[model samples]
Target chain A: MNKTIINRLLVNRNNNHLFKRTYSSVGNKIPRDPKYAVINSKDIDYFRSILKDPNQILTDKDDVDPFNCDWMKKFKGNSQLVVKPKTTEQVSKILSYCNEKKIAVVPQGGNTGLVGGSVPVHDEIILSLANMSKVESFDPITGVVTVQAGCILENIENYLVPLGYTVPIDLGAKGSCQIGGNASTNAGGIRLLRYGSLHGSILGVEAVLADGTVLDCLSTLRKDNTGYDLKQLFIGSEGTLGVITKLSFITPPKPTSVNVALFSCHSFDRVQQVLIRAKKQLGDILSAFEFMDRPCIDLVLKHQAGTREPFDDSTPFYVLMETSGFNEVHDGEKLSSFLESIMGDELIVDGSVATDSKNMTSFWKLRETITESLGKEGATYKYDLSLPIDQFYQLVAVMREKLDGKALVYGFGHVGDGNLHLNISTPNQSYSKDMLDMIEPFVYEYTSKHRGSISAEHGIGAMKSQHLHFSKSDPAIHLMKSIKHAMDPNNILNPYKVLPQ
Target chain B: MKIFVPVKRVIDYAAKIRVRPDKSGVDTNGVRMSTNPFDEIAIEEAVRLKEKGIAKEVVAITMGPKASEEVLRSSLAIGADQGVIVNTDKPLNPLSVAKLLQKLAETEKPNLIIMGKQAIDDDCNQTAQMLAGLLKWPQATFASKIEISESKDSVKVTREIDGGLETLSMKLPAIISCDLRLNEPRYAKLANIMKAKKVQLTTKTPEDLGVQLNENLKIVSVEEPAKRSGGSKVTTVDDIVASLKKHSLI
Candidate 1:
């Protein structure tokens, strides 16, 4: 049998088992947990008293609807009230009152999450951290910065970049995502290959527990081995553990020179080879290694305005690589040699290097615009997965064949960290439950079988709660539940998320 | 027409200033250095003029040690066409700097010389005026806005005066000292910073420029200003009056 045909047959055979298994009762109308108390006039009065500003207390339906819906618009709740707290004390008071009253509260930062984590699934009171956007303090010598959780990521970057420093994380939704929210979801972006994840970069985090006790663990020291590292819990708790009010993280010095190059690879194997060679050759200066398939770029060009195709002849894959360092001449020489060797070895067929910032920005746009373009294609089933680098593109090919003529399956992401963003959309741009059924369990099962993560950077909010077992073991799930119970006994902090009921 | 922009490398504004143990000067060891903020504004203004097609080229000049070339590179990154470094490790007074710039201006013969009103380190605020006087050109100090005539023969400058605004129109070949409100300097993008490495940068010594350095002013001693003492809290008017009287500040 032909290799491609054999692979397709194997995928089909494996998917049959997935099809036989029943759906995990996801996408059904989730009933609001009745154990939690509903928001009433008395709760509103208490919120008004605590949040003195009239504008902070948003009770009007028009004012609260935006907070009620997730950014993807896939999940919408009937949240009746939204309270924006300006200080950590106010957050503590609100959470304490809600915990005592058994009134569920959903803590929202910029609300720019994909998994519907930041929005309420029921009539939970929305706690908006919009008013707490402030840079508390910054140490110029050590490059340690403390910012309120409500501070937008881009705003913090803007504030620090001028001072010869930069926030460690960079994401596609930087303009809207809050730093606190970034910490809560443990966002892994293009620069993760260079700066590592927030788990290591975030030095300390201040959070409010379910009962309104403020956990002040905002440490600025880089090395502290005292006792248990409790701040790590809030880093990726998805706001289920607590509400992160402020965070202190070390900012790396801004790179004096940045160089971007776009290359066309004929195969995923070649892409992986280029990544390995880049890591070996470029060494410390290597910042990002992002890859995308032909369909991903095509959709971006089709849907996104002001975006032109990077290459005249579209190939199997495209890679966007960036290098940042102190000396431009040295970094440029290293990059030139790397590019030459890769091209000489025929690992890349065609390539273009940006000589100016404008061109570099355009190169990054091709990779960053994938998510926004997928949304424009309508009814996208987005999956952020971390797989073995060798099998990264294999899953995309499998989904493409399985959903052939039924939908468009495109893959793109930060290949440097072995993470892939797989997006599937209908040709007619309409929602289909049958299409949903075909993709879910099979994708999860295939990922599990290959020892890949079901949710890589985007945490398991309400959307993937049922599928947590696919990635974690029963003991691990039980431990997580036990922790949730111990910390938030009333289940008031972001109820119906992260853990399976 | 050509625009000459003079930038200076200074201790970064964000870096903390610490006096040396010998009380000679502020410690610069391992501290970040950047283009003086006001000079960055001057560079931005010159680049804006070139972008508007009023100037054919922008030549940024800096006089200091070899490390000063970094600021010139930053100037080029912000869109200057060329950079000139007056190599001198020795500190120069305002008059000495004015003399060297006078020699360069005579040779370059630019239509306009725009520079910062004062370097933050020295705060002398006399170099631009001295250069204008030495070159015998009309001078506009503390310029908040500038406009050139359609024929490009003369220019108009809006000066930020102590109490109000002052507008002056002068012929070509003039000097204008930039104020804080002149323009906001743009960030030197990484690509442009790399491209700046290819731009023309000439290195010449003060002797090569046919100018001799002379520091008429001498510093006998340098001392940091006295630390402020904490003020005591007073709850009543009588208590405030008593404290003020005790200190003889009433």
Candidate 2:
């Protein structure tokens, strides 16, 4: 439980064999038939000789804390030992030896993740692959990039941008999220509306099984109807199956032009009307359509002062619209005329479009600041749901009406993907319980009634596990449990997480 | 003397895991994966050992699908000499993996083997012990410190214990499971990254090792851990004492 207890459990081994002198900082106290045996002196030199570079490896506790847990403050454990293996053979030997000794191993990538799936829930060893990030190969012709999983999403974008290719899927956490974790999580971000998902883009995956067996499914071929699509399992298996080391994804061609429009809506109805009208005219060019509630818009304006609103008039809702096309002049003109037509129909009261790149980013800030803005408001409760676009709004409206006096409610969504983000807030701290007990279930029931998903893009981490039943069926749950049992029989891989207790 | 260390890629040690409410296994969607931190330290130990001239070569090995090889390549960046991957899509247990590595050991014969004490994904601390049992070699679990003899035929290791550290002497070909306190792991320098690409890596299959991997261990269920409900805060220590007395604890 304490550091001393763990340290005492790992006494040193002294060997006089092969002409070795041993010295201890403490007195000449030798260890007994310790619970953990010390390796012979010769083995130390043997391991040292095999390493390509040992200077960079860290073994101290100070070096391990940063690597221990993830972004979500949920799963925690004591693995008094941490190791970084740089080669596949070293990983094999480590596994082989650990297998011989009955030690456990945990693989890690970019530690930025929501699920407690990455950290240890027990005193298991950890393996960090942060150093393994690199672009192994890239072929523009095939529109594929083979890279190590540890590579960050931002780095991948930078690497590919120069080659006129872009990783279609991106999120706010792109700067910190690693490609390996992205593949493992099957992450869906803002760009998912425009570019599908990893199930389509990720061509192959290379991962290590629980026992250190490297399964190489890193196929570059786009259409390989093999006996079984094993890569899909690990794509979102959360490392229960194995550690993903490399990924081969189909990078899409870069868009020639991008445009954005921010519109003020008197109500959610007008927002929907504008969406229907814009989609009809803009059609395939409409890449993103995001909605923001009044409270969220107020928070953004308050927090990020001087970020201009498109209109001087006040509105209860706002919509951030974006479109990407191959032709700049033609697409820009079409987008302008379409917005003008919608404004004439009273679907949009007031709005402004980004004329340049700087303005385009400024418009995006209005949308990206939702998470931060919600943080500014006290005690924020989040609900990310997916339902029929029309029903999604109705659910939020119903929750708002139900909680009119109980608490403050805000509702918005990514209309393009039918994902809704509803937040409940209270002026008083006491309302939090009322909000959770009374409001949370009501919102979930509404989503379920509409045949909606409890989780859309953000995964069902510890925060949303309790509501998983709202989205999944009994047979589906049964199959998932069977897979978990088959892969991790000892129930050690991220114990107490992912599966319902 | 060369050393080969095995590191399994697993969930990032920090990500929060959520068990599905509907009795499904953990919701893996958006769960992050990384190198098991303990294995990283093991790799650091090997790299330090080799840099200190205690050993000659360090090869990193991982047994999984192609994605697992990324961790091996990461080891290359961390200063591993090269790598050998036993590629398999089928999930295997500690015993089976040990069998495959035992076959590879017959050819490589690494002087020392090191790994993280356990993986973060499935915290089963069995692979190293099973490997040692299969190979009939002295096993050191949770080694905090390791000192090699000059001739490299023996090793002095410090094992973590419940009360204090215990030291032992063992002959050559020993398995040492690394603890967090072993050594500080290093990052791959920009210069070494290019070199890592040229590093030789031999990819093998279960067929190559002649080890048939049919999983033996079976899981009956994958349940989520109990959630810690939000508790009311106590105003002061005296109020806490009153609550304790009310509960008849002290």
Candidate 3:
């Protein structure tokens, strides 16, 4: 069957059932807003009146329960009602009514996030964009896709494949994540190396304020130097400022040929050298350059079934390299020569080139499965930080040495973009305050010492709000709070998030 | 030894299938179709056999509409040395598909044939068995694990049965159907997809293959399963017990 036609024929029936879990086993410490008005029969009546479709208003516990938890299942909210509106007009009316009633609301998308950002914190109303999942428009000649905030990243990717275009953002969570959520969080993914960041690709953003004011600045242009590009504010606002409803982005044409290669390196410095050489040799085709430690891959092999160690002898580090271009023959020859040179220079101890798509996908799984593998091990103290490539693993090594095996600390991420996913794990699978206390100030101090960012790709949702000060100065944080207050005076739009108390 | 693998085009595994309102059959109006997943496993196995040097060439053949040529190209991208497409717009039942395959086997005369136990859609699980029966060849179905014998004249396969696994040894020119646990099929890389364009795909018609085209089984009517109502949430343990009691469950 034609892939384009087939792609459109069947929707994924599995994810809905897969996401349902018995109300989280996580503790009930996250607080609900006291200021927000409780739901009376009148409020429910008003909500029902606004949404013509009664089915869109989910009051049933089983149906609305999944929206109350984050992807990691680390946080849970006791939200009573969830509303999914199909149109921006409906969203505007729902928010307008909620605002008039002084009811707190949590704007949600795919609800796939490392931090407790998408789900409700308390019994606030859950305003979902689930029904607003359509590609509003697409220009084949310009390669710009204007999609509703609720459109899934993976679905858009498949949709664009026939048009010879690709989604600018690519992540492990692409299958379930919403582009609106990604843009709202300024999601930096594997494609960051090739396509820059969401901040660059997203040309315009359309959001609804807490007061139901539509900030309609969604534009589809290559260049716009208009005053005060307000879209940037909502790009990483974390829904604390407003609810993102739609967005327009410039997408790149799909590459005709692709190549994936895995290299084993002895040290971080050697990995850096390999990356520099690959960029110079592969040039514009270099899509990703990621590295993981022995411990990380070991965890993956132990946790993810069917995933084996790519190399017989374990090296200190492994780097997964990806390249894509227009010509397969040229790209293959270019990559083969680069691999030969790297081997000749002894920069890499051993390497494996994905001979086929099967091997290539498995190789990607080795790199992509790191998070799930870590999850299987135990409670992971996660940190997405940006540091110099030369000394990226130094933080992980320092933490590991300092922790003295009380917890396992490992580092892995997009090394090309200097985004290090520093993970401190409790192998015993029990989270304790003492462990957190030991890791925080020390890790923050170390990151600051290196002049690095505390939060790289993953935004400062509920989890890292307090730690924002470690990365930003008091004035910068004060300005963010001021913006938050100005945009959402009631603090009802995802209250107690993105900003520290 | 040369391996012949027959694959079918079906709705992708990731797709959520919904019965059309009229219930004629599965509504494939907008869904993305790809090579049947089980067939992918068979293709993976054939390619692996060729890679292992036990098999010299792997030929992937599919019978369907012109669009099924995409499935053949995908097979080639998955490592098939060549692809053959039997073009026909008409739908073929399992028996019809088997007979057409049988005619192709008479002319191709491959040493062995490998295919999926069944296409996920329809899921008759009859094609491989019927083909083997018509050809009078040894057959192994529901194969989870496969091993090439030293003689290379026979294959050792572990079949996943309901109760337990059963091991079987089958001779040359045998028909083997793949189960889910056999092996994970590799993705079709862009480079391979490009290379697949260069692969020799010979197109033939079912009529030219000298096979009778007749679909004996007719689908009466198609209807979607009744939608389950959303469950209610209870505040406490007593509420749950009371609801269960009200539903006459516990």
Candidate 4:
């Protein structure tokens, strides 16, 4: 439960290989494997020869810093070389050499993950997917797009706009996050409740294994229930097993008529009631049901530019409900009736509906840009958790109680999908060991007590791998470890990740 | 009032058009194409008029190759009562297009012809005026706002100009060209597109219409704009400030 015991236990972690690096942002040495070759100048020459572009090899201190850090700047890696491979064959060659030399590699996508998954934990060579972004194949009729792993999510969405299709996954990081990274992390955004998880939506994956072996399970058909769904294993693996090079998936047709309503609820219970009413009344039209506390709205309105309070008055909690239907007038009437009933039943206090396209976009900003606004305020100890609909607020309340007013605690997330992004705004603008010590294990333990997932949407990157046991059973994790070792026997794919040390 | 909207197919604004190696013109091969953005605004305005019950019917027309039907179909998808394509292989200048539109105007006899002030591909703001002249009808060009008179006899259009705003009242059968500020076009739904596909699109050859199109102006050659290289990024704000001070610009 404490640092000494935790560090001592981590010291005895039975990793196949172990090496300790000198520096880390978290003040803990990554249990890097010693069997993995320390990256040397010779490796850079070999990687440069295989990648073919000297510019693809980033070794400059400034150029390498961005790849070495996570999106939140919470974790930093000291890796000297970052190799970008444009083709799968290039990745094959690089990995083959790295496997032969026992050099560790961290496959990086957009590097926009909230967790520290994309960056190297130690002196591992970084294999970036930026150069591999291309639309390999597109079937406009079927709405299935086959894209190289590094295509930015926004680019894909824009590319499919003319075809009347849209990428199912939508997140705040869509502008920067790659489709491969989203698949790698199984990133759940606001649309997950509507389009379903990427596990079902993603059709196939083509990846390069640890030892230069190509795993091409890239199928584009909607229904291929042949044998074990091998692609599901790589969906949330966080790049520990292989480097995702290409993906072929079906994109859902873009919803024609989308309407958003921002409403203030009296409490979490009232929010749940409104959610139930929306699902029952709006039915198929209800796409997103997101809620945030009063503090979150206030912070967003204050810090985020051009964003105003959705309602005239404030309530304890707020919900942003979106509905999509073919007929605008019909869908508008349905949303209006739902809103009237929720307001009439006193489940919601104040509400505003987006009557026009302009208002709809403005209303979405109040909920979509919360993460950026949170960062502007102070240090954020962010946790993305999955709990039962009724039990979501309990963890937030517990965290607030434990912090005891030392931090500004708030929760907001896709409540329709039972995912809560619990955040703690540290009084200091930076994290302290004391604050984390109080927050961790306790949050994980509470989530475990409630049979909730410790890392929902975001995968078990380096940050939460130690506590993954809280969510997965021993046997299940044992199987996971076996799969990890089998796929990457030398532990060279992405060492010190996913599977616990 | 009956509205006739002439939309054109052009390379989508989002597309970065590349010039062919021969330098004859822009390489349209494998490039994304869409209805000219300004014409899209005109279509939106016409659709709004029909939705508001100010206009009885919305008819869309285009003249070009078979590929031009796509724009007409897009117009129908957004909200057009009927679509007509004047099939012709010859490159039509603004004058030739105006002459062809005049023939259509004489036959269809729409009360008002709503169109874009200028197609983005050419940026030639001539078709509306030429058509108005050819039909001997009043015209309101560069219209940012259009208000159909309840009497159904005329339209008061608010036009944007360098000096200020110009308000003009034009009689029925006038050509009203739209500007950018008319309205924002909505994303046509899948259902509407499917319905649009089912919507009747009439195709008539230029010979059948007895309308001849000829290119009066020739585009000599086209070249792509120079590619801009990335500027050096300052590592920090302090570095930016120091660099600016070093250059004596601070």
Candidate 5:
């Protein structure tokens, strides 16, 4: 039945001959990019007042430029209008009007996305969910929180923490990322090792379809077992499925005891050993398992002068681990005994554990500082890849050898989950292109060989679209395109993102 | 026709905000607060139409802390039919804010609702769009022109787009957000001050809305943008051209 629907759409495309044959030899064919004509000023005002009032729409280029791009600054596009609807009905009506006019609507959440998923890729109309950020319902007893998709992750976390509940997933971009975008991208944050994916915790999603129909699926049930699971289809569809307006999600209980520790390892082999021991000893209590290489530590020490590691001498690698349990001493004891057990193996050379909440935060600062430290480390090339925990460190070692001192390479992994951030830096602009071209394919090839993902967390925005095949299978790619075509058959929603052009 | 206008209180547009050294957030110290300028225009437009007798009533609502009443009072002072303030200290995003407003609108069922295009703070710009989605209402954004139908049940709107304009029409009970081009919002006067003080404001909390905050996304730090060093100013046309040529910006 779905294939028939796709065939019908394909036949329409074929009839018009709008599909371009030359697809740049990358991956997917470029269906003629959607054409967008500017909405007139008078029409802009008319649509503006159709909202609760005419005062909330942003149209001036200066006012909307920040909304047109994500934090990556890699994908930039122009949009003629930005619409903020205060209610779901308004969104439906707005979309219906846009559909009639053949005005492609790109839904945007928090523009902090690393992928260009949340921004316009053409002169399409930008339908912002900014005004839709309202808490509709919460059942503390059931541990479910329902909110509009545009709510800031940090804001939601702050609200839940004080109430003895917490947003299960946490990431560095939480403050800037919206819940809708988080759900849309199926964001795997630092806490994914503990909370799992949104596919489990996200109870339901209310989305606006292409024809302005509202898919009202905001149910707070843990197990629906419904036929087809329509909500799951939109979770990681990257807004190609529909514009997520609201979400019902399950929140985890706030941990009573939290301990963070940073350890220095002399070898990548030892680092993996320590991670295995920590996971085994800590069990479910282990919340985060982060790995950092020597170059990463060196960059931090150089850029952030006051910050220092516990080791007297520079080590080849460092590991930061956090464990949250019901009892502070029990968790501490487990962590200490694990360290002692590994001492004989010499998996860890030096380490420090946080005794208090303040100290725990202080310890985690080293891991969080990695993003900022990279800015100071020359012309840097960054790749966030997900591979087998065992092979992650080895890939970095191999890449370092391949660079042969032409560039410096650093590796870090969220060991609990298979995500690693590998950064390469060229000393000068003369070697930038070589470093990028050589490192990108080399890293992606290894990731593919190990059945790893090229984009672990930061999405396949314009930056990684060329290498999407490394992580995605041809069938997966075709299905993703079919989903995109099913909803935005006009090929309008964030064009040239996620899928190759 | 009765219109509902939503107002938001945010940091004053002109003020240069500084992030606290602790990396928590911007220091609100000496930071002036004001009605989000676009929302102020929304209130003004609604009140103007009411005064002209085109609108039978102008209701003003706000979603923020009690301090936001200052902005709400400005709306009431501008002659809104009444005021409702969802009193909560929680920092709401577009999704939650839209849900709360949708609930309020469901009860009141105003013929029209108006709000700023986007809040200055957070700047997610999701509220209006998501609200439209939730309420399933038609929306005209960045409106430069709005005309009520003779039947008073439909509206014709002009929206601002990049490089050009778009014209749209929809039945009443629609939503319209305002832009800078909408109108010059007027300041509240002393005469209306007494009237605004008496205006009732409704308050709601996160619990009231049945939603708790998602804490997974925490703020590690809020640092100020790195300051750029002062560049040589080219005031004269000759100097501007020379500087552009030197930088290859020409």
Candidate 6:
């Protein structure tokens, strides 16, 4: 038998046990797709020839383990080889060769994704984009930045902030998540209410298709009326259609003045009233409007260090309002007047304004760290949903009633965007299948009935691929499959993701 | 005991610099102005001394136009107890500044005075030395580390020299110029900035200090450094030698 066949046999023997374990979301054991080729010694030599650096080709079990698992630790793969390409040309050559050999490849950047989109499901080759981090160019006049796919989000922000500009997106994982991954997933963050979505801000993208054809759509112009916007397909394709190599996005000017105010609401209805009033009063200056329930705040105080309640008395809900503007005096006056109006109208029970940077950071932390604090409680069933603004907290209420004290159910997220992060966890900090079963189809059905998105910002990776039907129509999904087939006929790019099997 | 710290407002180090059209000096119009980074380190050290209970108060003083009061406010936000500004629109040299500071020192009578080794704009490392000379006090320059004695009458400073460190001990009422490794400055909190507006800031003129501006130096013109040209490729050692000979650099 050939050496490649022998290696494939060994890999199959090793993964035979994993095949018996079924995934909870898909409710089926995902067998290794037989069409994909396994990595052998010859394949490693080929990768080494293209990479030209021995350190870039990771074959040791210890070195490649981090790439094989995701940040959530929910999905693990058995990829035997990992390759880090330093240039777009190197990535092109590697992908072209892999396409010819019918080997599956997973393109990863930062590997901080909540979904298992960046990791391989089976013994596929891992294409890590860790070495291709560089800022190609930045137009100071136009405020457009062109950077490689592997640059960390926070690094780019720091680079632009001193120049009187900043990247429009801001996420909690900014210190680790890569800009390329952000564009690929169409990440919606706190600044979305002010700067809009990546679809509007990302001017151009350079990507390589499954056949190694370089699609150079990296245009820096704000307006391009040319035929089809081909780059939009790869924006949220989750690396299935192609690999995003570089991006050019417009950045917003850094705000000279920022003010934050935390408000305590008696009920969810009061929170909505406060939001309505804030939108009308703090018109062009409102940058963020986020909310968290009392339970969420309680968990943050219990788990997160150096966190305290913003008010003396506890309430049913809390709202964090942020404002950014150019004139400090004008913005400060506006924020104070808005606060006074809301308090006088009895829309809020209590409120506290952040008089300094320390208070501002602490107030934002109380809202931003809710997700991190929830992870400490137990195995959480996380859902990022987009629903009607009025019915935002109804699902959380329904789940809380359904679980009936068995699990802790709470809600928090960007209220300005109608996005809610509904989380459920047990008190014992263990993964329970019964709890997951009670949450899944019902959650999807409720979301579908409300005509809401089941997966709001987090893409439908291996976790929610089967549940995509709840949000997307049959015709829309059919067209998506056709597009995927037309772009990648061999299905060698990020298999078993985005599209349903 | 009280400590006096002198801060200077200069163009932000990160801002792009441009020369004036008349070649007189660098253009300052529309440029971001900030407290000299070294002076920020000096203010940080003084505030830390007060926090440690070694110094009872910190007084930040600056001499410039009215806009320079922003730097004094910043220092106040960073934990200075009081501020004093010598309001002067006319340009002042190192010697003129030293004379004004000497006049203030006679009345304030602070136990210690700390300042930056040099201003980034002029790079003139003379004000501290001149002040110490005029006051007849011991002086320590390029101080990377500082330690005050238990009795608080003397201090020890570790200076960063070319190849090694030098330690110097000075009596009370000494002058110390801070080096880059002294300490990292803290950002001014918003609450403190709001409160800094109410801090007592005394304003005085150069005439009020009984000092007349007398400058001994004059700058005829200012120009940017010459741009470097690209080098030619050489294939052999003889070619390199020929290139060097052509440029008269051999």
Error of 3 at B87 (Å): 26
lDDT of each: 0.84, 0.70, 0.82, 0.81, 0.73, 0.84
Model 2: per-residue Cα lDDT over A319-346, one tens digit each? 8888877776587567756866776677
- Top of the candidates by TM-score: 3
For candidate 3, write residues A133-225 as lDDT tens digits. 999899988999999999998889988977878888888877778898998899998889999998899998899998889999899988999
Over 4 Å off in model 3, which ranges? A1-34, B1-250
TM-score of chain B of 2: 0.89
Worst 10 residues of 1 chain A by lDDT: A5-14
- What's the residue-level lDDT of A187 in candidate 2? 80
Q: Could you say which candidate leads in DockQ?
A: 3
Q: What TM-score does model 1 achieve against the real structure?
A: 0.67
Q: What lDDT score goes with residue A399 in model 6?
A: 97
Give the alpha carbon lDDT tens digit for every residue of B9-67 in model 4: 88756454567898877877645466887888999999999999999999999988998
TM-score of each: 0.67, 0.57, 0.70, 0.67, 0.61, 0.69
Model 1 docking category = incorrect
| Rank order (by lDDT, best first) | 1, 6, 3, 4, 5, 2
Candidate 1 share of real interface contacts: 0.00
Better of 3 and 5 by TM-score: 3
The alpha-carbon lDDT assigned to residue B229 of candidate 5 equals: 85
lDDT by residue (B1-250, candidate 3, tens digit) is 8889998988766555778777778888646466888998999999998988899999999988887887888788779998998889988998888898899889889988989999988889999999999999999999998888888888898999989999999888899999998987765544465567667789999879987788778888987778999988898999999999999999
Best by lDDT: 1
